[model samples]
Target: MASIARRPDGKWRARYRDDDGKQHAKHFDRKGDAQKWLNEVTAAVVTGTYVDPNAGRLTLRDFYLEWKTRQVWAPTTLRAMDTAIRCCTFADTDLAKLRRSHVEQWVKTMTATLAASTIRTRVNNVRSVLRAAIRDRIIATDPSEAVTLPRQRRTEHAMRIPTPEQVGQVLTAAEDWFAPFVALAAFAGLRIGEASAVQVRDIDFLRRTLHVQRQVQNGPTGVEVSAPKYGSERKVYLPDALVTLLAQHIERVGVHGDDGWLFPGVPTSPRNMRRAFDRTCERVGLDLIPHDLRHFYASGLIAAGCDVVTVQRALGHAKATTTLNTYGHLWPTAEDRTRVAAADLMSTALDARGDQLGTAEG
Candidate 1:
């Protein structure tokens, strides 16, 4: 129920009871203004888009903080989201007053200093907060719903996949203890964090497999063990050479127990690992990071005729699409397969005819 009445002070008061029976009132200088405000409220109610006048009083930052507590995001992701929210220009703006223009302006500001991917991450983080606000009825629509983002420039040349020869040189240049760690990434396709978390028992020498269970990540409380990215826990088969190398390293280093880390100490720290890897690459006269080894491993799988699903599983990707998107260029095209098949058919027919002629002549 809503009403407009003139008060003794000559001010027109508009009051209404919301869906929950809570009364909201506002005073205007003229009766038409009060009636117009009431009509808008009524129309909003009829359209089922009614947002309580007080609900949107919370600032974007306040809403983000509230929404953040309920997320099950990993510590790294939480840190990233926190950074993104903190960098928002409209962080102090009330959610009720936030418009698409504000979000667009934020994107424009970020594009000036941030990379395309970084800008997208920041924008997506804010978009998620606004979506939660909508679900909570703090706002009727997402301010970021129509905001434009910079295009992510990803091409085949963007990803650096180190050559097998270069990888071998780097592995050979590595110290005895570090060679096994390098092999796991280049041969077994484990991320540096996953490699750091590998236990002695996680390796099955007989089965020639490595079970990825967790990853060592930088959490809110410093270095901690957590589930793999996107929970991509799976077994990756090891090459015979890598299996032998790991066995020898384990024997020489001596693990404390079944739960002992495969490459303990400095190798587990991603920063230290990168430094060591950089040193090894310098010695081999190649420029590469440890992550480039993973690309090498994926490329090898594609060359060996592994399908998208097989490569995805080997690389511990959460989705087959992720595998295809990253390594699609490496896979053979349908035309290549067709040409190979046609050539093989022609060669077989020619060989058979020659054999028949030899038999008749005999």
Candidate 2:
């Protein structure tokens, strides 16, 4: 039997103890609600699934802290993870006492405030912690996986994929400021840091390639030059236009071999190119960011009939999904490539002065 105590707020308190010699109490708005909760807790205890809140139990926040320390993520990445974890209402809730209902409510609250990507990131963080719990048998199942995920929102402000021609125009427009930046980003698909911190020696003109050995990072503590993001530290080929542009930039700026930084910054932080990029974009009449150039690059590769596997390697991405998710739209239609091949029978009729002839001639 359950005993109920009423408060001035018309709420009732339900009390129970578990086999672990731990006491639990909950306040409900109605006597019926109190009785129902008592039954639930009693049932949980009988099944050995009851969470003894009194047993110095760990909470969601506690689990996250433990898991975060074990991860070797970059400082920026860890900070982002911390932000995601803090947004959860269950961050401080007893991990053992946490139920599916508690997880669901937290998800709802997060969904109401965050974007799809933000929500996904936060949920993934929770999933990481809960998965470990599931593996350790702390919980019977992973509640994060069981809960429904919110739909990803596709907002207008999301990065835009530039057409091949537009990409050329943008580069031509910002010849001095962005041509090299655009080339490295579009042709080599280097992340901002990887590209910005590139040493003059990193450019292999003979092989038509660029080596990605390091990257610049701007974190809360300060700026630091570090290794590439994930396995992004690899070599990638460049297009003829970009190669020519890089060669010219080298000639104009002059390099002292591999030791000379390619695009030196004022504060010596190679990772701080966002402002320079934004200013260059304004001068070019294009409302695009440097990172958007990466999306445009992926889209261009896909449109140019490069396979996903090829794009993944070209961009130094650890996985094909990362390449596909960002620039899947660039994947050209099979028929489009087929039509170009099909038109090979009459090369003389369609060849003109200058239009992206949609030919494999490039």
Question: What does candidate 1's lDDT look like per residue over 1-362, in tens digits?
Answer: 99998999999999999978899999999999999999999998898788897999999999888789999988888888899889999999999999999988888888888899899888888788888888888999988886779988684868999887888898899998678779999999889888877888889999999999888875555677888899489999988988999999888976644468776563266666778888888887898878889999999999998999999999988899989899999898899989999999999999999999999999
**Index of the highest-lDDT prediction:** 1
What's each prediction's clash count? 0, 1
Q: Clashes in model 1: which pairs?
A: none
The Cα RMSD of model 1 versus the native structure comes to 3.3
Q: Pick the candidate with the highest TM-score.
A: 1
- Over 188-208, each residue of candidate 2 has an lDDT whose tens digit, in order, gives 777787777777778888998
Which window of ten consecutive residues has the lowest lDDT sum in model 2? 263-272
Worst ten-residue run, lDDT, model 1?
A: 263-272
* Alpha carbon lDDT at 46, candidate 2: 76
Candidate 2 ranges with C-alpha deviation above 4 Å: 1-56, 153-159, 173-178, 254-259, 266-272, 332-362
> If scored against the real structure, what TM-score would every candidate get?
0.86, 0.71
**CA lDDT of 319 in candidate 2?**
93
